[model samples]
Target: MDVSQVLRMNGGDRDYSYSNNSFLQRKVISMTKPIIDDALANLYLDMNHPKNLIMADLGCSSGPNTLLVASELIKSIDKIRLKLGSDELPEIQFYLNDLPHNDFNTIFHYVSKFQKNLRNQMLSNSSPTCYVSGVPGSFYNRLFPRKSIHFVYSSYSLMWLSQVPEMVNTNKGNIYMSTTSPPSVIKAYHEQFQNDFFTFLKCRAEEVVSGGCMVLTILGRQSDDPCSKECCYVWDLLATSLNDMVSEGLIEEEKLDSFNIPQYTPSPKVSNEVEKEGSFVIDRLEVSEVNWDASTDHNLNLSGEHEQGYNMGKCMRAVAEPLVLSHFGESVIEEVFKRYTNNIKVSMSKEKTTLVNVTVSMTRKG
Candidate 1:
């Protein structure tokens, strides 16, 4: 998995595609800070030891979210270090893991900035000398040494698996997301999601130390039903736009038909699978039901086709533009992005309740 190749496929830009707007994602990460603090507090209180604990942020994208999360974790470790009366702080090693196509340079820049800030924070005292590292590979395989990581955190990145289901590709369109489609398409997607999720859990368990705690957060749905229109609105809109392009002969229908984002929604069933893995026991699990008004839509685009009036949209474009352009062509790319913006505006104006259920789960290895 060459880094360049991965970036080429994922639209190259490693920055947050939609981070310009202070949308729910930024808000969610902020609101969840106390949650991480509480979890770390409990881990320090209950775990065998705390002073030298290790922490890693798996699938940390290059943006404010990663930096903020890392800072919080460092603070938690500092607090615990003081309580133990140990001069030695935990060795904070951050694993900025993403697909090969991830912007490692941006992540590296942020890691350096974070380290510099940490250095400044501990000018007078012996602070935990944080070691920053980058892991440019899929989380589906060995990401670190066995039992090496003590505290692992990943946010908003795991729901997208490595690839979508082959069965969905067999269909001319993503019938699973279509408003008028058979129930089986949804069932197939649900099954594929389960498979991908279990694989993710098993892989992480192998890397995490026994008694290690991982705070895993992802974009999920509150409903167990796979056919929930609210949960699939973004996908539906994109698919519809692609169909429009296809009908207009902008791009081949086959190209649109074969494309799919490797995504999955979590449910209690997936939680049960985590428990069954025998490596992780769920310590905490909660879903934040989030909805936002139009005022929060962070639109930063000033142009025609690249314009996405939402911060999240812009950030997403950075991540997806290269691939979209190559696959859909320049003209189609503009049209699709325009349609995406229009769809988002419609969703916002109609007070459409776009369901983005965040599942914050803490698991400890056996």
Candidate 2:
């Protein structure tokens, strides 16, 4: 099966769903609010007095986070409209986009309720009419009409490559490009990211109007090293768990050798090069360190390493279980994660695990 056919966040509103496990992603969104606000403010300022506004949230997985993005964008645009004392507010059309396999029905189910809430919050007679629709496809390709979108927002996405590189089999006993991966493996991942990211920008450039803005928050590395501990440790631990299973005759070692994660955490410099090669101008770029256990509730008295390991395991499994299930089959999932949780607990007992996130603000240049 292809990557697009399988990659999706854990669906439905169950306890282990993406909706519940996405607190970390939600934190990424919250931390970048100032950047989002500035980009939207500039977009509104540049538009002057448009009658309608079109926006999109790319990689909008199924969850509260999906609607949270739309709601926040709507609220921000409305505030700008009120501040400018515009005689008439523009009608806003929002496109929520993700892979074809995304649980869009879950988002659609909540649309009416979300719209009703938005309606109640409007305080002015000139309030903008909001329309929300889902666009199912890869963001690496064009999904909107030419020169249509005014603003674009994506959070906790884009670190994902379109697919795992064909040459990834060369990297033995690893699911991602790690410190020990051959230079060829590293090169393959980097090349794939450059290709996908450039394609992404090209597609969006055709869709967004001139002077439009995009604010993206993506998992990235802070340093030039692609195999930095912050970028590769999670996958290293996951690989260790898989290896443990292999040792126990639970899963084939060949399966572990064949599988590689279809994701990359690029450095800021790489991002800059891709943007420069595309149709946008970088307005702002910021990298922030986020603790792996950022979502843990310290107040819950979950102080021990075991509890911390459990929390981290749940979070990673929610985001990654779908892909792992597709590659390794469902039978080994529980055992795999069981070992994964223990590995995390042992690691957390030693030192803090922090992941670097990159937030980029850009404008589509004419």
**Most accurate candidate by TM-score:** 2
Question: What's the TM for model 1?
Answer: 0.84
What C-alpha RMSD separates each model from the true structure?
A: 4.0, 2.1
The sequence of per-residue lDDT tens digits that candidate 2 reaches over residues 73-174 is 888777787888877768889999999989899899999899888766766654458899999999988899999899999987899889998783478888
For 163-280, candidate 1 gives per-residue lDDT tens digits of 5555633546662345554555556667776776678778778877777777777777777765566567766766777787778987787887666555666654557767666678
Q: What's model 2's TM-score?
A: 0.94
TM-score of each: 0.84, 0.94
Question: What local distance difference test score does each model get?
Answer: 0.63, 0.85
Give the residue spans of candidate 2 off by over 4 A: 120-128, 297-306
Count of clashing residue pairs in every prediction:
13, 0
